[model samples]
Target: MVKDREQNSNKEKKLLVSLIWNFSTELKLILMALLVIFTLATLLPFIPSSFSLSASDFRFCISRLSSVNTTTTTPTKLSPENNTTTELVLDRVLDNGVIKRTFTGYGSAAYNFVSMSAYRGGVNTFAVIGLSSKPLHVYSHPSYRCEWVPLDPTHDPVSTTGSKILTDWGYGRIYTTVVVNCTFPSTTTPVGGNLILHATTGDPSLNLTDSIPVLTEPPNSVDLTLYTSSTKKKQYDYLYCGSSLYGNLSPQRVREWIAYHARFFGERSHFVLHDAGGIHGDVFEVLRPWIELGRVTVHDIRGQERFDGYYHNQFMVVNDCLHRYRFAAKWMFFFDVDEFMYVPEKETISSVMESLEEYSQFTIEQMPMSSKICYSGDGPARTYRNWGFEKMAYRDVKKVPRRDRKYAVQPSNVFATGVHMSQNLQGKTYHKAEGKIRYFHYHGSISQRREPCRHLFNDSRVVFENNPYVLDTTIRDVGLAVKTFEMRTIGNRLLRTRQ
Candidate 1:
C-alpha cells in the first residue's frame, strides 16, 4: 500500500512540470513577435514620407541646433585679453591674436573661419626688416635697430650636396616666418666666401666681414621675423611675398617699382626682398643691400611641400605710409606679379574700402566685384578668343555674355567665385542689398590666367533668375538693375555674361 501511494505522488509531480514548461515556451514566442513589431515601429522614421528629406534639411537641422547652443550659452571670459596687447598669456588659445594676424582690417569681421596652431608648419626663425622712404644715413638712421647675424661657420652642419639653410629671428614674439635658402649648399666640394651680415637691434659690435662658414649639412628648414621703428609713421609699408620667389625684382627695377607703387599709393611704398631659391640668387644678391642697410628686412615664410608647381607668380606689398606705423590700412591688395586687378575708379583704395565698410552689413563685407575682361586688344577685341593678358579691356556695368570654359566667372558673383566664365545658378538664392559700395574686377587677358582659380573665385550670397548671377548678367540688368540700380545686380549680371 505504501509503495503504491509513493508512485502516485511522483506521477503528480511529473504532470505539474510538463504544464510549466509548455506555458513558458508559449510566452517566449509571444515575446519574440512583440519584439519584431516594436523594431518596425522604431524604424518607421526611416521610411520615405510623402515629403522626402533633403541633404539641406539635415544641414538646416544641424544649424538650428548650433544656433540654439549659441543662444543658450554665454561664452566665458578668456583668462587673458587677446584683442589688446597687454601682458602675455601662456598656454591659451590665441584665437583673437591669430585672427588679427591673418585678416588685417575692416572686412576681417566678416571672415567666419577659425585656425589652430598659428604656425603648424613651424616658426623657428625670427628676422627684422627696416624700410626708409627717404634715404637715411646708415650711420644714424633711428630705424637701423635690428641686427643681421651671419650663419656660424664652425657650428653649421656639413654636407657635400646642394642644400639650403633657414634661420629664426626675434627674442620670441608673434612676428615669426620661415626664411629659406640662406645657407650655402654642400657640393662635391665646399666653397667658402665672405657673407655680408645684417644686424638686429643695431649691434655695432658685429663683425661686419665674416665669411659664412661652409656647411656639410643637407639643407634643413628655418623661420624668421622682422622689427623696425616708425620713423615716418605716415609712410610705412610692408611687402610680403605671396608665393615666395620675390628675390627677382632688379635694383633699378626695384626703384622703378617703388616709384610706380608710390604713385599708385600716394606714399613711399616699395618692394622689400625676403628669402629665395637657388635659381633666384642673382636677383637675391642684387636686393640684399637694401635689406642690409636697414632699408628692408626680408621674411621667409614656410610653405607646405605640396606647392611644388607654379613658381611663375609671386606677391609684393604696397600701402600708404601709415600701414607700417599703424597696423591699419584702407585696403590690402593681394595680386600676382603677372596679374593686377585695378579698380575702375579714381578714388583711393582706402576710400573704396571705406565705402564698403560704411555700407556693408556686419555679416557680409565682401561686395560683389565684376571683372572687366581685358583682352590683348591686339586686334578687334571682340574677334579674339576671349581676351588675352595684354589687352586692357572694360565692360559695361550691365551684363555679361555666355561662355564655355573649364572655369567660368559667376554672373552677379563676386570675383572670388569663378574665373573665365560664370557659374550656373538655377535654384539657389541669397541675401542681398543695394548699397554705396561698388566692385570692379579687372582680370587681364585670359592667357595669363592661373589654374585652380577656386580660392580666387567664389559665388556671391545672391543669385539672379534660375541661374547664378555669377554666370550671366542679362537677366539681372533687364530685371533687377533697371529697377533698383543695385550694384550687386549689375555685378552679378556682368559676371554671368562671361559664363
Candidate 2:
C-alpha cells in the first residue's frame, strides 16, 4: 500500500511538469507572433500598400531597416521658407516611368508655335516651338492621325546635323526644334499638323498643343530678295542689325533712328528693315539713298501677317534675317528700332567683338532709359539736342541682365534664334558683356501707341551725366538731315496736291 501511494505521487508530479512545459512553449509562440506584427506595422508606411510582401520583400525591408541609423539622423520636411532654395522633390510612377511630382510655383510652363518648314526630302517636316519650361516629351501628329508620334533628337538636314534640343533662354523659357515625318505622302504646299508638349511637371493628364497650319513652306520663303542690291552681294566685315517694323512711326523718329545707327555704326553697318506697316512715301524717299547703297534693305511685309502679336512676328523676322545673312555678315543683332547697341568702353562694335574673340556668343544687357530724360521740359527738338546724343546722360528706370535681354551672335554658330537669346550654337560658348556693352532701350519717347510705354513720362530725376561717349556732332547732323528731309517731303506733297 505504501509503494502504491509513492508511485501515484510521482505520476502526479510528472503530469504537472509536462503541463507547465506545454504552457511555456505556447506563450513563447504567441509573443513571437506579436513581435512580428509590430515590426510589420512599423514598416507599412515605407512599403507601397498595393505591393504584397513576399519572402524577398520582407528580407529587403529587414535589410533596409537595419541600415538606417535613426539615432543620428533627423527627419526631412519641406516648408514655404526653404521651398525655393531646397532641392526639388521628385517621385517616379511605379507602373509608368513618368515623373509624378516636381518643384511647383517656380514658373508657369508655356510654348509658342514658331514656324514649320518642309524637309528637303519632302517625306519629313521640321517644326520649331518656343517653350517657357523644359518639357519631358514633344509629339507631332497630322489632323487625320489618331495617335501622337514622339519627336526625338533626330538628324535635321535643314538646320544642322542633329535636331536642336531645348535651349534655355532664362526667365523660364526654352526653344526646341522637332522633326516630324509624314506617315503618308500628301500633295500639299503646307502640311497641316499639331504639336503637343508634355511638360516635366504639372498634372500628367493635361498637356499643351498648338496647330501648325502651314508646315510645308519655310518661314523664309517670303521675298527676301526684294531689297537686295548688287552691293549687298559682297561680304563685308560689319555688325548688321535687323528689325521688323510694324505700325506707322513718325517721319522724324524714323529718320533719327536710321541716322543714329548709321552714324554710330559708320560704314561697317547695315540695317535690314521689314516694313510690315505702310511706311510713308516721304520716309521711303529719305531712305532711298541708303537702300540703293545696300546700307539698308527694306522688305514690304505689310500684307504678310502670320502671327497674332507683333512680338511673335518679330521672332519670324529674326529667323528670316538669320538665314538670309548667315554667311554674308560676321555678326548680327536683333532688337527693336527704339533700342540701340551701345559700347561704352569700345569705339566700335568690331572692337568689342575683337575683345570677345574667345567667345562665340555674347549677350548685351538692356538699360531702360526713361522718357523724361529723352525729352526735357522743352519740346522734341531741344530733347534731341540735350538728351538724344547724350543717351548715357539719362537715368535708367530698369536694367535687365544680358541673359534676360537681347543678344548678338555669330550667324554661322547659331542654329536657332530667339528675341532675347540664341540656341544650338556650334561652339555653345555664350558670354555676357555686362559692363562692356549695353543695349540702351529708349521707350515712350516716339512710339506712344505702345500701351506699356504710354504712361511713362519724363519724370525721373536720376541721370548718368558722367558718360563720355556723347556724339553731339552726329546728333546735330542727323537731326538736321531729318528735318530737311521732312520739309522737302511736305513741300513736294503740297505741290502735287496743288497740281
Candidate 3:
C-alpha cells in the first residue's frame, strides 16, 4: 500500500509539472519578445546621437513584461491549490460510482468537479462546484480529453452552460465557488472516463496530461425506455451532507443533535459529518456511539483548511459530500451542526418529506433563536436541564429580511448546489417552506458556554437592542423526549453528565 501511494504521488507531481509548462503561454512570451525588438528598432532612428535608456524608457519595457505571459502557471489542472494543500486526502476512486473530482487550473481556469450524471436520448452533464467565474470551454466528450467532438456536427458547444455565484465577500485573484452545468451528447457509456476544462487554442488532445476522471450514472437512471426488471440500484430515504466542523464546538449540543436527528430521520437516515478540526476528544467521544451504529460517517477534512475557500472550504466540502453520496439517497439535506432541524408539530417527518418529494428541492426557513438569552418566565433556569436546545429557547422576534434558509434536495435531480440552495435541478424548487418544515437556528450554540443564560427574560415580548427576545419552546418540548431516547439508546451515563 505504501509503495502504491508513493507511485501515485509521483504521478501527480508529474501531472502538476506538465500543467505548469503550458505551450501557448511560452509561445505568447516569444511573440512578445519579437514585438519588443521590433518596436525598439523602429524608434531607434528618432533618437539623438548619445541616446541612452531613461527611467521612463525602462518603465515602458517593464509594462511590456507585465503583459507577456510567463511560464509561472499558478492555474493548473487536477492539482492542489498550493504546496501546503498537498497533504489533502483525496479519494481517487476511479469507479463509475465515484462522485467528485477537483482541479487547480490548466493555465486560465480551475475546476472543482462535484459529479457527473448521464441520460440517454438527451445530454450528459457534470457539476463543477468551484471554478473561475470567467466562462470556459469544456471537453464534455467522454473519449477525448480536450477535443470537442459533438455527436452532431452543427451543435454549438458554447451555448450550453449554467452558473451561479456562491461567494459573499470576495477574495483577491482566487477560485470562487460557482455552479457549472455543461453538457455533452449522451449515448456512449462513460464507464468512469476522463474529461477536462481548458482554454486550449491548439488541438486539445495534445494537453491530456491533467484530465480529471468522472463518475457517470447509467443512462437507464433517467431514461424510461431503457427500463430493466433486473436493475438493482441501491436506494436510501435521507442522507446528510454537513459543512466543515471547526473551532471550539459544544460537545453537549453535538451529542443531542446526533441523537435527535438520528431518531428524527429514523433508522435508514445516514449523516455525513466533516471534521475539519472541531470534532475534538469530547466531540469524537460523542460521535463514537453513532459511528459504531453505522448511522454517522466522519470525514477527517483537516487539510482542506489550507485553501481559504468560502467558510472553511465548506462549499467544496458539501459539494464533495453531494457527489460522494449522489445516487445513494432519495433526498440529501445540507446544513450545519449548530442548527437543530425541526419538523413542526403538525407535520409527520415521512409525510412532510413525501409531500415535497414531487419537487426537486425545497428551502427550509430558519427560526433564528438566541444562544445566550433564556426564558425565566416559564420557571427558574435550574428547572430546564436537558440539552442546549431545551434551556436556550429564546428566538428572535424581528425577522431579518435576508434569506439564510437551508435546503434539501433529491440528489439525482440536482446538478450543483449552494450552502443555502440548489441549482440545475430537473424539477421545480419550492422556496417558501414555512409551515411544512423549518430549522431552529441557535446562533452561537455550537460554542461551549458555562451558563448560556446571560439575560433571563420574564415574558416572550421583552426585546433587547440587537438581540430581540421571544420564547418558542417547541424544540425545547421535543428536547425532553430526545433526552429520554438518548438515555435508552446511548446509555443514561452519557445523559447524566450533561445534566
Candidate 4:
C-alpha cells in the first residue's frame, strides 16, 4: 500500500510540471505577438503608404501628429451636433496711404482715401475723387466759416477709366473728381473746409455720409517762381517746352538736343530742365551760355523727395512747370530731352498754332501730337544731323496716328499733368494733329552715338530720297559750336586736375 501511494504522488508531480511548462511557453508566445503589434503601430506612420509620397506631404503629416495628443484626459466642449465652431477675429487696422474702413455687420472693407482740393482759380470751387464701398453722394461744408453746401446737380459724379471697386461686396465703387462750386465767405482768404460724402445702398433711408477735410491750398503746391531763367519778364510766346533729365549725359549731346529745339522753335521757345540726379557738371558748363541768355534754365532736383519713384517725381516736376509758367507761357510741351516736336507743314510752333486758329474757335485749347519712334543702327557718328530725319525717313515708323488728341497743351487750361498727358481743369478739348505734326522720338540713337555718321541708317529697310524739311543750317552750326565748347571745357578740366 505504501509503494502504491508513492508512485501515485510521483505521477501527480510529473503532470503538474508538464502543465506549468506549457503555460509558461504559451505566455511567452502571447507576449511576443503583443510586442510585434505595438511595434507595428509605432512604425506604421513612419513608413509611407505609397512610393509617390512627397516630402511636403510627409512634413505636413509630421506637423499634424506633433500638434495633436491622443493621450489627453481633458474633455473638450462639443456642440450639440458634434460640429466645430469657427469665429473670425478682427486683428488690427493698417493705413498704408490708402483709405480703409471696417463695418460691423458687413465685415471689413477698404477703399482709397477721399481727396479734396480747391480749384486754382479761387476758393469757390473744389474737386473730389475716390473709391467707395457704396454709391456715395458727396457734399461739401465749410468748417471755420460757411455752412453745409450741397453739390451742384448739374455737375454730376462721373466714373473714371482706371477706378474700380477693390472689394467683392458692392458695385460702382469708382467716384471721379466732381467739381463742387460753392459761395465762399471770402475768396481771398485761405479757408479750411470739410466734404461730407453720403453713402447709399439703394435704400434712401440707409444712406451714410462721412466727412473729409479740405484745405483751400494744395498740400504739394510748388513755388511758382522756382525754375525761370528769363530776364526780360515777357510772356513766353506760343510754346514753352521743358524736360525732366536723369542720369549722366554727355555735354555735347545735351547741347545738341537743346540747340535743335532752340533752332527750330526760334526765340519764342524757352526750355526748363529739371535735373533730377546724375547730371554731370560738364552739362551745366556747356549750357552756361544759354542759361545766361535766358533760353535754358536748369533746376537741381536732388533735394526733392516728395514722390516715391523716378517717374512720379518726373510727373511732379512737369506739373510744377505748368503751375510756375501758367501765366507766362501760352502753351507748355512736357517732353523728354530726346523728343522733339516736328511740324512738317510749318517751320515753327507759332505757325502751327496760327494754322490751327480755325479749330481754336471751338474752344479747343490743348493739342495732342503723336510720337514717331526711331531705332538706332550700327554707325561711326554718335550724333545724327538734322534730328535723324534722314536715317528715320521710313513711312512705316511707329507714330501716334489719331486726330483730336495731343500731348501738348495750354498751361492756363490745365490743372495738373502726368508723364505724357494733361488733366485740364477748364474742360478744354484736345485736337489731335496726327498728319500735320509728329513728335520725333530719338531715344535709341541720341543716347548711344558720339559722332554724326551716315552709316546709322544702313539697317533701315525703307529709305526716302525726298527731304521732309529744308535742312536747317543753324542746327548744324550750333552743334559744331557746342562740340568745340565741350572739348575746350574737358581739356581745361583735365589740366586743372593734373595741376
Candidate 5:
C-alpha cells in the first residue's frame, strides 16, 4: 500500500511539471506575437495615409455576436452587468503633455470603444482610453465634458451616399481645451463638405451649424476644429437628483440605484427631483443648472397639496419630448420618487416602446418593494443598528376591504394605497416578464423626518382596492382595502377598484 501511494504522488508531480512547461511556452509565444504587432503599428505613421475610407467603415470591430435578434431564446444579449467592460487607462508622464492610444475592443456592448492619443509637437505621448458606449452614451463623462456632433447623411438631397463623424470635447474643468479631428479612412471614400452635424442632448432638433461656422479643410483626410469654453458643454435632457437629500440614504446606495435605473431606462437618460415635503434644499440647489436649461428640470411640489399634515407624496415625471414624443414615447410612467424601473434582457425604454407600439395601452410589470423597517426615530439622525421592524411605531399598512372604493378610481391618481401592480399590456393580453424585466419601488429605504412622499398610481395598468378608510394599506392583489405606505419595495401590485 505504501509503494502504490508513492507511485501516485510521482505521477501527480509529473503531470504538474508538464502543465507548467506548456503554460510557459504559450506565454512566451503570446509575448513574441504582441511584440511583432507593436513593431508593425510603429511603422503606420510612415505609410502614406489614404483618404478613401468612409468614417463608419473606419470603425474596426462589428463581430457576429453584436447584432440584435427577436428569434433567439436568450433575451439579454449584451447587458453591462453580464458583459466584461473594456477599460483603457491613460497615464501622463509629463506635467503638460497629451497621449493618444488607439486599439479596438468589441463595440456591441451599449457604447463604442474610444481611441485617445496625446500629443506634444512631433512626439506622441501616452494614450488614455474611454468609450462611446450605450451606458456611457454621447462620449461624455463626469471627468470630461465631451461633446459629439453626428454627421447627417441626408444633406445633399440629390446624392444617396453620405458620411458621419462625431466630435468630442474633453471635460472643461481639468482639460483646458478640446480638439476635434475628422479623418477619412484607408478603406473608403473622400467624404467632405456636404456633411451636417446635429446636437442630440437638450433639443434633438437643435442644429449646431445654424449657430456656428463649420470650417472645411483639405483632401489629406483630416479636418481640425476646437472648442475652449467649458461651461457651454452639452448635458442630458432630464434632471438628475441626488438621493443624498433623502437623509439616511448613502451616496453609494444612491449611485447603484442611479446606475441601475439609468441603464434600465436607456443608457444616457437623466433624472430630476419632486420633493413633495421640501426637506432638502441642497439637492435642489446642486441640480439647479439642469433645471434652468430644461436639460434637467425639477418640479418641487411640497405645498402643492397637504393631507392633514400627516403625509406627503413625492414623485418624478420624465418628459421625453426629444425623441418624437408621439412615436418614440408611447406612454408616461408615474412612480414614487423612491421607486425605479428595470426591465429584463437589456430591454430599454425605447425598445419596449417599439414592442408595445402595436397596442394602445398596457399594464406595467410589477415588483414587490420591501426593506427592513427601522425601530428608531423617523428623522435621518436615527440609527438602525439596533432598530428592527418589530419595535417600530408604525405597522405595514394593509389592503382595505371591499366597498368605499370610489376614491380609488380617479384617472389622475397613479398609485394605490397599498403596493401598485403593473403589466406591459397592449390591447387585452398581459404576460409576466423576468425580474430582470422589472421596476423598483424604493420608498421604504428613503424615509425622512416628515416622510418624503405618498404613493401615486398614474400608469394605465393599475386600479385601486375596494376600501375607503384603508388608505395607505398594502395589498398583493385586487379586492382589498387601501393602506398607507404598505408596499415599500418591488413586486407588489395594487388591485383595481370602480367608482
Candidate 6:
C-alpha cells in the first residue's frame, strides 16, 4: 500500500511538470506578472493621492517592478521647496560669525525672504536684507543683556530712509524683491548678528545666537557678539562674484577659464563660484587647484533650483556674495565664468581700475566671440588638444545693441546688486569703458564640453549672420600664454587632462 501511494504521487508530479513544459514560457510569465501586479496593488493604496510622479519616476518604479506593474500614480503640484510649507534650505554661519538663514517660508502672498545680514559699518551697526516680503520688524539682541529688542518697528519703512529694492529686475520671479534696511542701536551689542524677520511687528518667532565684533572702549560691557568683518591682513584687493552657473559645463573649459583668470588677476584676487549644477564630474577636479590656492571658493547652491526665482536666484546670489565679501575686497567684479574680463594689452587691471577710482561702479563691454568660427593655421583636424580660446580666434566685430552689461563695484557703496549693474548705491557709474576694460564672451561655449571648434576659417568670406568675424587673436594668444603659465606654475604631476 505504501509503494502504490508513492508511485501515484510521482506520476502526479511528472504530469504537472509535463503541463508546464508544454506551455513554454507562457505559464511562468503569467504567474510572475500576476505576482508583480498583486504586489504593486498592495503598495498603490498606501501612497498618498497627492504625491507627484513624473514620467521618469514612473519609469523607475516600472523598472523596479520589471516583471509587471499595477501602481496607479497621481501627480501633484510642487513648489520650489520640496516640502509644502516652511522648509529651511540653508542655515550657514558666515566667516564673520553672522548666521545666514534661507528658508522656503509659508505663503502665497508672493512675498519671500532671501537673506538678512547685520554688521557694524563705521560708527553705526546696520542690517541689509534682500527679499520680497512684508515690512519686516527688525530686532537686535545684545549678548550681555540677552534680550531681543525691536530696532525699527511701527516706523515709516514705507518711506525711503536708507532703504530701497536693490533692483526691481527679475525674470518672472514668483516673489519680487526689494532692499529693506534697519539700523541697530549702537549702544547695544549682539551675540551673533542682528535678527530680522517677517512677522507681526514686535512679535518674535524663533530665537538664535551668534557672535560679532567687540568694541575697545567698552570692553566688558560689549562682548564678542556680531563680528562680521575680517582683519585688514585677511582682506583681498579684488573679488569676483559669479552668477548661478548651471547645466553641463565643459570641464576643460572651466579649467582653462580659472587658470587664465587666476593668472590674469594675479594673487590678491579671489573668485566666488556659485555652483547651481554645472560644477560636477571633472569640473571639480579642474577647480580643485585654485580652491587649494585660496583663489576660488565654490558654493553648492543646488538647492536654490527648486525655487522658481529669477534665473536660479541670481539676484540673491549676487547680493549674498556682495554682502559676504562686502568688507573683504576693495574692488569686486560681478560677471560670469563664460565671460572673461579682459583689459587692453600692456595695462594691468589694477592700474586700469585705479584710473577710475572716482566712479563707484564700472560696466565691462561684451566682446561676443563666435563659437563656430575659428582661425586655424593649417586646417587641423577637430581635436581637444588646444584650449577653446586658443583655437577660437574669430570675434564678431559688428556692434550689437546690448540691453545688459557686466560690472565691477566697491561693494561697500553697493546697498544691493543686480545681475547687470549695482544701481542702489552711493556714487556714479562709469559707462564709458571703451579701451580700458571689456569681457570676451564665447557665447554658449561654456555649455559645450568636448569640441569647441565647429569650423575653421582660412578666409574672410564666412558669413553666418550680419556680424562680421575678424581675426582677433588677442584672447587666443592669451590662451597660449595661460597654457605656458599653467605648465610653469602648476607643474606636470599635479595637473591631468582628458586629452
Sorted on lDDT, best first, the list reads 6, 3, 2, 4, 5, 1
Cα lDDT tens digits for candidate 6, 1-499:
9999999999999999999889969988999999999999899989998986799998998888876423322334456656564433355566786666554334344333444343334333444444443333223221111122323443321211234453545343664444445443554433323333332122245343322222122223322322344344437889999998998998877877888888888889999999999888778888787788788899998886665667777777777788778777889998887778788888998899899888889988887788887766745764346678877777777765663579999877877788888777898999989689888888888898667776777765456666677777778767668888877866663356552
Candidate 1 local lDDT, 1-499, one digit each (tens): 9999999999999999988787998889899999999998898888878867789999999998786331122223335546544332222335464322221122221111111011101122111121111111123221111122234465443322111111112211222111111222322112221222221222243212212222222233221121122231323332222234333233322322222232344333334333333114444443454344344445453331122212311211111111222222222233322233222345553454444443211111122222333222234433233222222222233344632121111111111111121122222322231232222223322222232122222223223233233332321222221223322222222221121
Off by over 4 Å in 5: 1-259, 267-273, 285-295, 306-329, 373-436, 448-499
Q: Which candidate is the best by lDDT?
A: 6
What ranges in model 2 sit over 4 Å off? Answer: 1-234, 239-241, 278-282, 303-306, 373-393, 397-404, 449-499
For model 4, residues 1-499, the per-residue Cα lDDT tens digits are: 9999999999999999999887997889999999999998898788866755679999999997889533223323435575865443333334554333433334233332333233333334332322232333233221111222324433323221111212112222233222222343433223332333333233243433334444334334533342233243537764544555666565655655665666666676788887766355777776676777788778787654332333424544555566556657656666666555566543556677666644321122123211132234424344333334333333332234542323666565555555546544455444556555555444443444344333233333533343222222222234454445535433333212100
lDDT of 5 by residue, 125-185 (tens): 1111212222333333312212212233543212111111111223211111112222222
Which structure among the candidates has the greatest TM-score? 6
lDDT of 2 by residue, 1-499 (tens): 9999999999999999999887997889999999999999898889977878589988998998889532222334467785644433354454565445544333334343344332222223233333222233333321211122322224211221123333332222243333222322332222233323222222344444443433333334433342234244436455555556655555444555666667566676788888777355756765775677678888776543543433435555566566556657777777777676666643666677788766667777776654433323344455434324333234443333432477877775665676777765666555558767776666644453221221212433533443212212222324455445535433333212100
- List the candidate 4 regions with Cα displacement exceeding 4 Å: 1-65, 68-234, 239-243, 304-306, 310-312, 345-347, 357-406, 449-499
TM-score computed on alpha carbons, candidate 2: 0.47
Positional deviation of 316 in candidate 6, in angstroms? 0.2
lDDT for model 3 comes to 0.66
lDDT of each: 0.29, 0.50, 0.66, 0.46, 0.31, 0.67
Give the local distance difference test score of model 6.
Answer: 0.67
Q: State, as a TM-score between 0 and 1, how close model 4 is to the true structure.
A: 0.46
Residue 119 in model 3: shift from native, Å?
Answer: 15
Separately for all candidates shown, the number of backbone clashes (residues 3 or more apart, or on different chains) is 81, 1, 2, 12, 69, 11
lDDT (Cα) of model 4: 0.46
Q: Candidate 3: where are CA atoms >4 Å away?
A: 1-173, 178-184, 190-234, 377-384, 496-499
RMSD of each: 24.2, 19.3, 22.1, 15.5, 27.3, 15.4
